[model samples]
Target chain A: MARQQRGIRTRRTILEAAGAVFDEHGYAATTIAMVLERAEVTKGALYFHFPSKESLARAVLAERPPLETVPVRPCKLQEMVDVTFVLACRLLDDPLLKGGVRLAVDQCAPQSVDHAGLFRRWADHLTWLLRQAREQGELLPSVDPRETVEMLVGSLAGIQLMSRALTERADLAHRVAVMWSHVLPSIAVPGLLPRIDAASDRGSRVTEDLG
Target chain B: MARQQRGIRTRRTILEAAGAVFDEHGYAATTIAMVLERAEVTKGALYFHFPSKESLARAVLAERPPLETVPVRPCKLQEMVDVTFVLACRLLDDPLLKGGVRLAVDQCAPQSVDHAGLFRRWADHLTWLLRQAREQGELLPSVDPRETVEMLVGSLAGIQLMSRALTERADLAHRVAVMWSHVLPSIAVPGLLPRIDAASDRGSRVTEDLG
Candidate 1:
């Protein structure tokens, strides 16, 4: 068990180092030697966990940290906002998330892996939340959950990308709040509007609460 | 003057070929030789027009085709929708626009050129249109034109990208129309909402009318 734990720790360290390198240089420009150097691990050790750069990228892409951290809330709409906010906050600091998003959207490395899976997961989660919101009478009757899910996913992706391009995502949480402000009015029922906190600070608050 | 015109035509041909190649293989994988093969131009001819691959990518990034084509409409809101629709249609078939967007968003080639110019131009134009809409009493008094412009530009980019990734942008017009449908209700005045045509077919109709 001790040996297994050590192996896990070493694997995690490699993944984190790889994430940072991938975030900086992107997929094609990134190399295993860079990851090994950053990780300060022997080539054999690094290869034991991740055999190739593609697998490392796939591992980085598969890291969905924010999803595991968001605590459930009574108001589904609030939970949805919290999810986006928390993700935005994580994206700001987490190399893994940043690298994953870059790899997923960057058209340079199409053969790496199925980047669409991340988007599909996000859409599915948002759809489930929207269904819950609809059941709770938080959403307007005219809202199509699926369409709204796509818009939410797509718009957030764009906002994050633009923010990253312009400011390296420094104001991502704020931009996401602005996006929700523009979007909520069109989809949320009037009764729920005042209750849902879509503030820029919500992410920090949620992060603290989760901690 | 005739020699200069011929030079311009050759440059245009090289740019078009470069755009198609960049759209397919992205900036990193693309080569001058691939472009030469695609354009069927000699090394001397290609070099005479574009100094390097970076210059060709920059030229493709600098290509602003949609702005020149969208005619002014009496209703500013209609014109805004028309701009997006026309852009969506053009994006469906135009390699220049596709490659430009790809290069603009791909962070892999950060040192190549500043690709944010295209996004800024789009936002500036949208803001101008929103201002006109405000003056004509077509927009909600509460709407912030700048914020809406960013959202419009960012969301459209995201939508087009998602469409491209999922379906090779086959349904970009429909997706863009859906975007406007969601956005128009929040920004447009109630009276103008019914008049604004955000239909999928509006792109083809507007394209024909413009021609």
Candidate 2:
């Protein structure tokens, strides 16, 4: 059991290292030698864990920590929206995840449907959440849930891309939350506006106090 | 005078050739030698027209076709919008320009500010049009012009990105016109919806019959 545990740890280490390398050097430029060098593992050991570079890259791109490992739990629509907001904020804060995002946005070829498919996954995730929002009476009946999700994700991605250009991390999260507050209400149910508005007021006050 | 005219023609040839090479090979991967070979011009001739690779690239990105070349006059805001719509359709149809767009998007790097600046130029162009729309009383009085412009541009670009993923042509202008029919009513002057609805109907017919 101890030997098995050590083997798993080594495998995880190699995967993370490969992710970083690919994100930096791109898939075409990254090499197995670089991965082995970063992981401080022999070629044989690396081969023992992964058969090929393509498989390794797929692992990195597809890596997801199980929900049970995180504090996240299934919840109501409003709660899911709140959780999604927090998760998006957390994703912006995570160092390892940032490279993957940059790779997807700036490096991935639009001509490659496989790469585009990877992006559609994020849209799919947002679609699922939007459907929940609709079911919970949190959204307007006239709203096309798919388009709302698209606008939300696409606008946030655009905002993050712009923020990354600004080269300043100061107050990014607060600004993003405020932006979300303004955007969220567009599709949200009219009756819930007061609750969302009050929450947004508090957010703005916090922003002012932070300044 | 004759020699000067010849110089202008040579410069245009070099720029066109350079744009093609850059679109095919991308920025980092493309070499001066490759550009020279493709243009059938010597290094001296290439340098005479453009001093450096960076300057050449900036020219390729910054190239704007003559406004007079477009079909519609831009004197009135409505005419300006019509002209802009026509140009947007033409841009997606042009093979060479589409290639340049591919090059521009694919060349984007997280560390690079140039690509962001390019998108800023796009936003700036759209903002200018929206300001014209406001002056003409086409926009709602309560709308924050900048935010409206951002959403319109963001949504159009997002749609184009998705469309390009699915199809060969980047024909987003008509779809945007359709979207604007619904979206403009939300943010346009009360009486403006009929005009927009007509435009939307026209665009849909164009897509159905032509596309």
Candidate 3:
């Protein structure tokens, strides 16, 4: 049991090291040797875990959706907003998630990497939450959950890409707050706005509960 | 004079071929040899026009903002809408523009490529039109132009990226139309949407006028 725990710990170390290197240099420029150096692991150990650069990248990009792990909220609409805010907050500190995001949007990745599939998964997650919002009477009658999904998912991707350029994602939560401020009027039912926390610092506030 | 004309045409051909390859293989995977084969130009001719791969990519991405050559419209907001439509339309047919956009979003591009700068230029262009829209009273009183710019520019990029994944951009103009359907009510003054052509075919109609 102790040996198994050490193996798992070593695996986590290698994954984190790979994420940092991929984030700094992107996928095409990254190599297994660099990850080995970053992890300070024996070549045998690194090879035992991630045999190829492609596998390493795939592992990094395969983070489970935050909604699956985070506690469910009373309000589905607020939950959707929280999901984005949580991601925005995490993006600032979590190199692993940030690297996955960069890979998801990366055009320069090899043809075998299904970055498009990542976007599809995100749509599915948001779509499920949005349907719940509609059933709860949290959303406006005019909102089509699928359309809302595309706009919300894609716009968030764009906003993060833009924020990364403008502020290295330091202000991502604030930008998301700004987006929610504008978007809620169109998607949320009237009088629901007052209950929603679209504040820039909402991420920090919500994440504290998770810990 | 004939020799100079031929030189110009050759330069255009090389650029087109490079754009197609870059769009197909992305910036990192593309090779100058592939471009030369696609262009059917001698090594000497290719070298004369472009000194390096970096210059070739910069040229492809450096399409002058279309607003410079396209006719100005009577309504600034409509003009802004048309800009996005025209781009969506062009992206389907113009490999060069498509390649440039792919590069602009490409994380695997070399550090020197300045993909971030492309997003900045987009913000500047949108900012110019949005201020005009506000001055013309086309925008709502509550709208902040800069904030609106970030949302519009980033959302459009996200929409395009999603459309590419979903349908290879075949449905991009329609997606943009749907986005406008949702967004216009929030940003535009009451009674203005009736005048703006946010239809999916707006791209074809607007570009026909340009041609």
Instruction: Give the best candidate by TM-score.
Output: 1
DockQ of 2: 0.27
lDDT of 3: 0.83
- Candidate 3 lDDT tens digits, A144-169: 99988888888888888878877888
TM-score of chain B of each: 0.96, 0.72, 0.94
Model 1, position A74, has a per-residue lDDT of 93
The segments of candidate 1 whose C-alpha lies over 4 angstroms from its true place after superposition are none
In order of appearance, the predictions have TM-scores of 0.97, 0.71, 0.94
Best by DockQ: 1
Please report how far candidate 2 places residue B32 from its true position, in Å. 3.8
Clashing pairs in 3: none
Top lDDT model: 1
Which scores better on DockQ, 1 or 2?
1
lDDT of 1 at B139: 89
What are the per-residue Cα lDDT tens digits for candidate 1 across A1-211?
A: 9999999999989988988888888887899999999999899999999998989988988887577568888998888889999999888788888888877776766565777678888889989988999998888888999988888788888888899888888988888887887788888898778888999899999899877
Off by over 4 Å in 3: B69-71
Task: Give the winner by lDDT: 2 or 3.
Answer: 3
Give one digit per residue, the lDDT tens place, for model 1 in B27-128. Answer: 878899999999988899999988988899889988875875788999999998998889888887788887888877777765657778789988898899
- Model 1 has a clash total of 0
- Cα shift from native, residue B95, model 2 (Å): 5.6
